[model samples]
Target: MDENESRISALTLGGAQERPMNEKLYMLTLSFSIEGFIRQVLTQKNWEKAYNKHDNSLRLTIKLDIKNNGRIIESIKLIRKAIFFWTRNPKIDHRIWIMIVKDDTPFYPLEEEEARQLLFDFNRDIEIKPEALKKGKNNIAVFVELSWGKHEFIEKNTLKKESNIQQIEKD
Candidate 1:
């Protein structure tokens, strides 16, 4: 093939196709459920978003503002289950791991040992089988054991959970 043809082929080659509407909804639901944990750790209602890449895989990073929370430990406790659920290999659809970035920058600064401990607690909360976590070169990752399909599904349980958590806190 010529250069022009080769360029066209590369552009067309690999990309994830759109998932079904229901599946998209499911993926969003799953994402929302996982993101909800940030609320407990953050003083703000919204957290920043970013995509992660390592080992040739795309992971999502929810750069949470975990600074203001008086105690990051308790917030970690509350969302332990939800974090594991969303980060699991496959649940209501979607296959990806998650990392909650907690830093003590202006106050405490980043510490891998502390971060590892928090990750350990969160990993234990997951109901399914979880693999031993290893700290990657730049960061840490808690691996989940399961093969997730490309179907991308997110269930509708998020709204109810959001409401429940909201009601409990009493803004």
Candidate 2:
């Protein structure tokens, strides 16, 4: 696999913000691919086929642990079964946003659909992936973390604004 594909296979996202009741709201978006990590429970045999939501039985568990000052503050584990199969439908992209609350609650999907036609424009092709006869989009994984605490004071700020003339000159 290439560098971008490798990154998309595993990643993490986290953030925290102030909320009512003196509580902090933390949001995390985790994305991963389990293309080759499946085995049979009885025979211990590796699965060798495209994952089908109708036939395949898979379980995913996500655990989040919050720590403060080298000690465990709060933790949560979410277990979910696969419902939508994205690999089979590569024409559509998917994204899931999980909101972690004090109580364990599951969310549902909203249904809406539309269609439109578009013109195609040919452009210069940039070689970013391995040469292959694949027809789909590239996967991207990004991790973000947000924290809350006493704001740190900076003595000398180096940030400055520059005009277009200055930018052109520097370039």
Candidate 3:
């Protein structure tokens, strides 16, 4: 028999009904337009003062530690940059930030409020998986995707499972 047929036969033999395993998985993605986002922030009067105080340089560096019950399990650092702009003259520098989490890194979910605080005053979008939203459930998997624009930040969540059985079935 061919490989596909053989595998099907093996699974069907003996009347042993096999059920798909539900392995938990999570992922996150963040996107934003660097120039558009920076310009949006700089337009703010308070932010303008802050920018000028820093020698007209806006330092963009964010560090987030994913925690469970106040214990950190994972840490993520967002895109970092130093942008210089003049208030009198409006000119946008061409620098964009794009990042994707590596597969090997551990996944952690932050509360909506916590995440919001981390990205406060910045234009960004965040996405997370459904399974990661369980209340009072720790050790859950989550994925986050972020995209940013001018005066628009989006956060979304999605769920995907990765399991050994699924891998074997595909093979």
Worst 10 residues of 2 by lDDT: 113-122
User: Candidate 2 has what TM-score?
Assistant: 0.28
Q: Which portions of model 3 show Cα errors greater than 4 Å? A: 1-23, 27-41, 44-56, 80-82, 85-136, 139-171
lDDT tens digits, residue span 59-130, model 2 = 334343433322334444544432223333343333321111212343222321110000000011111122
Error at 134, model 3, angstroms: 14
Q: If the candidates were sorted by their lDDT against the true structure, best first, what order would they fall in?
A: 3, 2, 1
lDDT of 1: 0.20
- Which one wins on TM-score? 2
lDDT digits (tens) for residues 1-171 of candidate 3:
322110001111011122334643333322222222233333334334544465332333344443333444555556433333342322323222211122223212122232222332332222223343445444322122223322222112221221111101110
Go through the candidates in order and give each one's C-alpha lDDT: 0.20, 0.23, 0.29
Tell how far residue 56 is off in model 1, in angstroms. Answer: 12
**Cα lDDT of model 1 by residue, 13-124, tens digit:** 1111223543221110111222222223221111112112122211222222111112111112222211221233333133333333333211121332332234322212
For candidate 3, the per-residue lDDT at 154 reads 16
* Candidate 2 Cα errors over 4 Å, as ranges: 1-14, 22-55, 83-171
